[model samples]
Target: MSKPLRVGVAGLGVVGASLARLLQRQSEALASRTGRAIVVTAVSARDRARDRGLDLNGVAFFDDPRALAGSESIDVFVELMGGADGPAYDSVKAALNSGKPVVTANKALIAKHGLELARLAEEKGLAFAFESSVAGGVPIIKTLREGLAGNSIRRIYGILNGTCNYILSKMETDGLSFEECLKEAQRLGYAEADPTFDVGGFDTAHKLAILASLAFGTAIDAEAIHVEGIETITQDDLAAADELGFRIKLLGVAERTARGVEQRVHPTMVAKSTAIAQVMGVLNAVTIDADAVGELTLVGPGAGGDATASAVAADIVDIARGVAIQPFGRPAHMLEEVERIPMQRHEGGYYVRLMVVDRPGAMAAIATRMGERKISLESIMQKGGARLARRRTDPPPAEGAPETVRVVLITHATSEQAIREALDLALADGVVTQKPQVIRIERE
Candidate 1:
């Protein structure tokens, strides 16, 4: 029998507990496959007395996560603590510096400080794995780092956030308002109480930034990606999208364009017939377009206790088997600085909903402005008897006999700058009553 590989888990939250249970349950199978027994020797969390619904009688418990990171009994550190710069960062760094392999499910940490951490881990010659960081349980990091390493990836995009997906799916399926869907999601434990990170698109941006680095062989640039949430998506916008044979999905897209790397997270319009459009509810899907492989899409649960833990456990098993790979699919020194493309240079179809005064020449004025910008409309719909409904303290539209008309336009591929300019002109011309809502159309 070979020696046992000792593993330490930090944070006994849902993910941590699931990881611990998996390590114990899959011990014999893992030992047979890896030629070593994987053991969970220690665990850490703030509230040690709280029942984790698992027996931790044999494992050592520590209040300070750093203690588990430096424990002599453990050979690998599994970080499930959910912060970017707190004890999670401190413990993972400590473990790597101590010459132990580290695996983490912290996407925020990986997205924000991945380059620095990769450099440090590579400098120490330790395995720094974060397969669970993006698209939970999908093994996307492994796919990009090894499975498709031969191809030159042109683009990587996906529906990365599950909370936003749940909200959008509910709005489209149930015809419920955004606020109503959000409240339901919160009650169902799909969204956080605040829900700012997931719904605001920052969470998806964080995951996409990491994927962009892996696909492009560049440094992680979370702050550079353009992000827009789905909070502003109204029932009218959903109806307009449905009428046009498209579904609205909050997508994080990273593409290698002629200008540079275009990384953005926004409400996107995908064709209803596409597979990505069918990936509804709380599921995530990532599509990679490589030079040789063409396009491949991986879809699965984005986040949950068991699914995320499975990914973390896979990383741990790989480490136990002595499978070593570069952090960003290449040597840290060889990774190039990402040249971020400006959002204005982005070319894509758009879904625009304009609240216009129902009168002659207003529609023509919009058409003229779009024509001036070289943006041709694919379809337009005018919703009648639609009035701006104010909730609580939100001020109503300025008093006018102006009949409310919702003009939805599906535009051909055009520069974002031109769209903004055209929208500005339409608003200034008094043709539009409110700021025109624009959603980018992604051709998958």
Candidate 2:
């Protein structure tokens, strides 16, 4: 067997500790599989005194992660430090400059600085692996970078964030409001106190950016992703989705279009019969649409100490086995600049929920507005009477004023421009009482 692959891990958090334990426990099996003994030789973290319950007996500890990254003792650097810049970025760069193979689970770092890092790795002919950066433990990265290499991928979409998924699934299953589910998620440790990063759709946007780059061989353009959170999703919308034979999920979608590659993270209405719709709770799912594979979905735990560590281990094993695949499936210079398709030009069916005054002319006015834009409606259903009006955030009706009712319209395939124009016209016509809820529908 070749010399043992010495590993230095920075950041002894949940994933870091889990990875150490896994490397220790699976050392023999991994060695037999990879033709090299993989060993953890050094580690760095903020609080060395913190009891992570891992035996770092023979491992050296570094006060500075950069020092560990550039250490002569380790052949590989595993960065579990979570950040797009600062230490995570600095340490990873240090390791690459020191001619070490790199593995990471930091999505933010990869999404933001992937190109630069990939260029460095490519120039050095070293592997830069980040299998755990997106959907944890699902191996979507390997599936895209290797398994589906022979096919032309048409689309890739998934429930990429577990915190958001947990909240959404909780809301749908228990009929709780968004806030209630969020609080529950926090209590369950699925969400942080400041949940904006995850709940506000930025987290999924980061993951989606990475996936889009791999699936399309495009440069990672996170800023180009059209993002929307599940903050506005309500029980009314969920109920309406059920009636329409659909389920609401926070999805990050990247696909080919005539204009360009379209990447979006939003609350989407997917048909219940689809594989993605069946994923619930904190589990993550990614569906790839390719010419050869047709449609494929991979579902598993999106986040957890063990699951993410498993992915990190897989990347380390590949490195140990002397696999040198490009970070984004293609050579860094070969990655094409993504032609970003604007959301307004997006073509899709839509679910438009309007809270309109309970009057005869209101429905007609809305229909006319849609008709003016040539938007075809699949169905128009009024949900409940005046007593069932008013959204959670809607102020109570003024005394003696006309009450409101929810009018949901499912439109046939149309451009986003047309839908926005129609909704704006309806609002101007004094038909829509509150801001309308418009969710893009994914038929598959």
Candidate 3:
């Protein structure tokens, strides 16, 4: 047998430690399959004294990740550091510069700097593997980069973040408010105290940007994506969506259109009966539309130590087996410049909620504005009658006084411009008591 492949691990966090344990347990089987033994020669983390419960006696320790990267004892560098920049970036760059293969689970770094890293790795002819970066353990990256190489992908989308999905799912299932569910998630350790990155849709946007590049053979462009969070979605909106045969999901969607590529992360209204809507809790699911392979949906655990480590180990095994492929499924130099489509030009249906004065001409004024803008309404529902039904309630509105009404309208597929125009007209005419709440709808 040939000499074993010595690997250095940086960041002994949950993922890094899990990867070390996996490598330790699976080394024998991995060796038999690859005809080369795999060993972890060194490890690095912030604290060397922390009891990680893993045997590190055989492995050398380094205080700085760059030192581990530059160490001559390892042939591969596994980066499980959890940041887009800083030491993770510095270490990965050092490893690539050292001509060692790299495997990283850092989605942010990969999403923000994947194109440049791919270029450097390609120029040096080194394996730049990040199978755990997108959708955690789903293996979607490999599925896109190699399995579907022959086909052209038209669109890809999924529930990419588990924290956001879990909160949203709890809100829908238990009728909990966003704040309440977020607090529960925090108490349960599903979310951090400051959960803006995951809850605000930035995390999903990062992963989507990476997937978009692989699917479209384009350069990584996180800034090009239009992102919207689920903070504003109320229990009323969820109930309304469910009543309309839909579920509100935070979705990362990328599609290749004639105008350009549409990359967006937002709270989307997906048909309730579709598979994507059925995905609940902290689970992740990705759907790909390809020319030859048709539609493929992959769903699984998207985060945590072992699950993510499983993907990282898979990439290490691939490297051990001598499987070297293009980072983005094409030569880095061949990646095309993606034409980013503007979000305003996106065509879709919308759900609008308006608190309107229940006077005789109020609905007429709102309808006229929508008609002028060519936004045809598919359905309208009036709520807030329960208060009026109570005999103990205050006296009804005087003859000329306007009563309040909750009006919900679902519009047919229309351009965003039409909706904006209609909203502006309605607000100007004082037909809407409050600013109209508009939520975009995605057809499954």
Candidate 4:
């Protein structure tokens, strides 16, 4: 057998601790498969006295991750310390500069500084891998970078954030309000206390940036992605989706367009029959459309220490076996610059929910506005009777506010510009009492 591959792990959080345990448990099997033993030689974290439940008896400990990165004691540096610009960034750069292979689960770092790091790795002729960065243990990165190499990828989209998915799933299934579901998610540890990063769709945008690079051979540009959160989603929208034979999910989508590769993360209406719509709770599903493979969807646990550690371990095993591949599938120098495509250029079916005054000619005014924009409605669903049907979460109506009703219009394929223009006109015309809820519909 070849010499054991020494791995130095930084950040002894849940994922880092889980990785140490996994390597120890699978040492024999991993050795047999790779012709070498994969060992955790050292680790770095804040408090050395803190117990991580891993047997670190003989393993070296470093308080500073930068020391661990450049140490001669390890052959590979695994960065679990996450942050786009701080110590995580410094330490990874140190490791790559030291001519060491690097593995990480930091999606933010990859999305923000991938091209520069990939260039460095290429200059050093080293393996730089991040399988755990995107869809946890689903191996979507490898599938796009290697498995689908022969295919021309057209689109890649998925429910990339588990926290958002869990909240949405709970809201739809339990008929709970968005606030109620979010509170439950935080209580259950599925979401952070702030929860803005996950719930606000930035996390999914980061992952989508990475996926867009791998699938389209373009550089990662997170700023180019159009993002919208589930903050505005309500039970009324969920009920309307269910009635329309659709399920609402927060999806990260990247597709080829005449303008350029369009990347977006938002609340989407997918038909209930689609594989992605069937995924609920914390699970994730990624569907890729290619010329050769058609549509391929991979579903699995999107988060958790064990699931994410499994992905990290796969990268370590590949390093043990001396497998080397460019970080983004192709050489860094060859990656094309992504052309920024504005969201207004997006063309798709839409689900528009409006709170309109319950009076004569209100519906006609809204319809006339849509007609002015050349937007055609596929179906119109009106919920409520003659009386006002106010949402339970809504604030008490004022002394003399107009009685309002919920109106949902399912529009045929139309440009985002048309939809927004129509809604703006309706809002200005006093037909819409509040801001309209517009969700893009995915027919597939």
Measured on C-alpha atoms, candidate 3 has an lDDT of 0.89
Clashes of each: 0, 0, 0, 0
In candidate 2, stretches whose alpha carbon ends up further than 4 angstroms from where it belongs are: 388-396
What lDDT tens digits, residue by residue, belong to model 3 across residues 242-301? 899999999999998877889999999999887899999999999999999998999999
- Which parts of model 1 have CA positions greater than 4 angstroms off? 384-399
Candidate 1, 155-247: lDDT as tens digits: 888999999999999999998889999999999999999999999999999999999998988789998899999999988788878888989
**Of candidates 4 and 3, the better by TM-score:** 4
lDDT of 1 at 356: 86
Expressed as tens digits, the lDDT of each residue in 394-435 for candidate 2 is: 677899877889889999999999999999988888878778
Task: Give per-residue CA lDDT, model 4, range 1-444, as digits (tens).
Answer: 999999999998989999999999999999999999999999999999998898999999999999999999999999998999888999999999998999999999999998899999999999999999998999999999999999999899999999999999999889888899999999999999899999999999999999999999998899999999999998888999999999999999999988789999999999999999999999989999999989999999888899999999999999998998999999999999989999999999999999898899999999999999899999999978435567555787677988788899999999999999999999999979888999999876
lDDT of each: 0.89, 0.94, 0.89, 0.94
Best of the two (2, 3) by TM-score: 2
Worst 10 residues of 3 by lDDT: 385-394
